[model samples]
Target: MRSLAFTAMLLAAPTAAQTAPEAQRPIAASKIVLVGDSTTAVIGGWGPSFCAYHVTSFAACVNLARGGRSSGSYRAEGSWDLALAEMRTPGYKNVWVLIQFGHNDQPGKPGRSTDLATEFPANMARYVDEVRAAGAKPVLLTPLTRRMFKDGKLQNDLEPWAAAIRKVAVEKKVPLLDLNVESSAAVQAMGEAAADRFAQLPPGSAPIGPTATTEIEVRPMAQPKLSFDRTHLGIEGANYFAAMVTRELAAAVPEMRPLLVR
Candidate 1:
């Protein structure tokens, strides 16, 4: 079994843009806040990729996400407070908050998972209300898929949470990014063998090193196979997922369309 390590320090610097649209109208500087657990956080999640590389130069991103946190615990851990502060900050009048959670919100974890009946959607709904109250648009994203392959097929454990997010987004009439479905479909299309490149390799083994056998040569374009770990995405994986999100956001929120490249 592979255990995903979440030990990366935040990289605040932006990276060179990749595959930007041919031309785009300028967008004024605006804050795009992210509120979520590690999966969508800045350090180890896809937020940095989406912020630093995917989006155009028009928007500023503030990702206030932590590892091992759920909707309930994230707020309890003071992460929510930090996001609220950002919402109140000046120059963010057109700000948008993207909320993604659920991996740590499952029942097994204590203080992490919320009671679905009372806390799950309620927590998410509160976030929507707060974001609006703070004068920012709130967009809720379904949890990204874990990319688990079972019986020769990819499986997703985020069904319940995804549904909850959808329900809340509908109730609040906020934008929704169905990353769960989009990511799962992308991974599934990559196929099993090709997808392993995204997986964490064994100790002392190079990610792009020679295969165990002399007959096999690691190819750069080959889809990096991701591991069995349910959470956390490697750099390549994170960028791939971020692209999906960026594309969706650009399409879903026409106002943000200028902030992204097709």
Candidate 2:
């Protein structure tokens, strides 16, 4: 009888290994949703690298940015609705949406450009308000700088748009990531020739012209054809800018520091 009772006791008890899985479970899963133009999209932007390398397993990083999207058009085409759905998704302890746009918002892009003085700031402010309404925090990022240089100095054509974004961030009292300033300074330090290494492909024979301020429009297709440009990012550029983004993001949103790889 004693031997039988001892066998039953042993069978009822759990081993140390059995409780390990529960202890290792993620404390609170968080989500990060990225929104912007091609510069923040998957194929040719830092968003891919940031999502893949910078985020820990406890976080979900979703890049919803598409090429050729402006602040006005991104919502006009139903992309913002999808983002709102993601923000409202239950179960995440915290949801962060990083918004960056301005490349396509610049003049000359049909169906994408917005009035920098009026429409741009209003669009950005609406984004901030809507993100809050969806129960998520919004971090505004100044547009990434275009890597065009003249007379051995980087040309910051997008400075106006960046300024507009800064105003919106301040007025809305949201976290701001000044990518334009940081990337501009970095590219200036690297110089024009060295910065070409960041392009998706080698620079074409055509000389950099005044009209080169804009990126060649890239539309979604079955098989997207990527080419070398001053704006789009290659693997190396993606990693470099992605690291910059991660560092600044950690500072801008201190709560996300532990989930980011640095």
Per-residue lDDT of candidate 2, residues 241-261 (tens digit): 999999999999899999999
Model 1 ranges with Cα > 4 A deviation: 1-27, 200-228
Model 1 agreement with the true structure over 1-262: per-residue lDDT tens digits = 1232322322433444543556775545788898888788754578878888867666778878887899999898788988998888885438899999888988899768788767899999999999989898999999988767887788787888899899999999999999988888887888756555554453245345323545457544434333345456667767888888998898778899877755
The RMSD of every model to the true structure, in order and in angstroms, is 18.8, 6.6
C-alpha local distance difference test of each model:
0.79, 0.93
Q: TM-score for each prediction? A: 0.77, 0.86
Candidate 1: TM-score?
Answer: 0.77
How many backbone overlaps does candidate 1 show?
A: 11
- Candidate 1 Cα deviation (angstroms), residue 112: 0.6
Off by over 4 Å in 2: 1-26, 205-221
Cα-based lDDT at residue 83, candidate 1: 91
